[model samples]
Target: MKLTSVSKSLRKLRIPAVLFRRLAVAALPLLLLLALATGCSLFERGGSSAISHKIDQEEDVISSNGGVISNLDKLDSFMERGSGSQRIVQYTIEGDPIFIETRYEGGRLELSYDTTEDAFGPREVKTYSCDKLVRTEEKHQLKYSLKGCGEDMGDGDLLTVDFDLGRQDKFEFILKYGFNHRNEINTVNQNLVKDMLDGTVIEISDYGLPVEDRQSIYRKLVLSNYLGEKQLSTSCNLKPYQSYDLTVLINSAERHYAWSECDTGRDGKVMTEAAEYIIGLVEAGDSFLQLPAATGSVK
Candidate 1:
């Protein structure tokens, strides 16, 4: 009678156990997918056109960890913007080329390097982005109110001009990224005549050169000097610590809109007579990475 009762109890429990096992098997994939979705929610941006994505948390090892980027969940969107083939700009630190991760989107470029992956030992991880072009009113102590670059450079970082902004003839700029941080008058300067609109007389320079004059001197200073030309050509002057490095044409002549990079030096200091007019940067050779070549397809 005891054996008979135990057998009946065992048979009753078998169905429940089989059902539970089946449920667990079915739920495993769903749980894994949820985890991935959660991981890709970190990147953010103010603009809709730009690829705004993030990686909610910083977890894992240097090579196997996750951090936020402009496009996290929709990495496909980024790949779509570029050719699957990519360019790896490799440069050396003291001797070895520091390995870095890089990406491009919305007409901007960004790179990252983790010291944990470098010979220097585990240092902080970094993410870089291009800064927006800006111009300030001279001598007016113009309260520097500039637009944010739509997205943040993650945490533990800051924003700065990647390339120097210069003025040509008040018009002509040589290479690219040279005209960073230029000062243009309010687009509505004409509307702001002291008597016409309100009490504000934008004192026109003797040659009627306001920001134009500033840019003219900038181009002229760097124009005649050899170092000036070289500084403009080689992206060496960009500082390693500076984030949001971008070039903006201060004048009409510089409208071509071009910027390039070089493999040399460690700091982004460049000697240019332009600052006489302004050219300053130190090349941080620690810039480098490894990837397949770009075939010019917009992904």
Candidate 2:
């Protein structure tokens, strides 16, 4: 009687071993796929978080070092408050050009360096509470101003005349005579004035002049003693309407000089000389290429 009851209980509880094993085998790939997907999701999130953190750190560095402050958040907030004056000063370090912009608003002085192209450059927003004070950047602080600041190269002389003339190796000039001076001018001047409205101003190229002639013209214009004469620095004269614009490419730099009828050096002969030589060339026409180079003092 005991054996019959035990056998009946065993039969009811027993499942097909082969069916259970088959089910487990079928689900194994699915379980492994789910685990791999979870791991990948975590890894992707970690990578994204790391990249974002790195970018934020870089931005912070740039901002702290003369870039737009991240904390300001609003453009208006960065603007200097009250009536302030601004000025820019350019200097060089290690042969690289650097610019400094200083602004004063109300009574506070704010200084920044090389911040933006049409704006300012990278430098801390240095604030000085006093109307006139010194800064830790000793050399620069001395030149600070409440109104404006500029290079105090004594005598107001520029060190260089930097020019950019693109790729062409030629010079073009336009000469126009004022209606009042029209009758006083000579034939060459008359012809130039006539061509002025016709868009036929003279064009001279480097190839047209020999090495000696080229050197002469260059010396006369670039190294001419007249360039350094303080008397030539007078204000531009806009009256009489007579004027000439000369554009040339020298040493890969494009140089331009313009003057009106009454605009002349104190001596009055400097412009007069240059005008005569140039006018002669316009009248030379095609023969100008074969004519001897101009030989005379540039007034």
Give per-residue CA lDDT, model 2, range 1-299, as digits (tens). Answer: 12243334545766477764565567556655765765433122321211111223211211222111221111122233434433332323222223333345566544444422222333223223333322112211112123222333112211122122232265333333333323111222222222232323343333232333333343344323223222333234553255544444433444445455555653234554555555554444553444444343222
Q: What TM-score does candidate 1 reach? A: 0.22
Per-residue alpha-carbon lDDT of candidate 1 for residues 255-296, written as tens digits (9 for 90 to 100): 222222442321122222322232221111111112122223
Runs of candidate 2 exceeding 4 Å displacement: 1-212, 226-241, 288-299
What is the TM-score (0 to 1) of candidate 2? Answer: 0.25
lDDT of each structure?
A: 0.31, 0.35
TM agreement with the true structure for every prediction: 0.22, 0.25
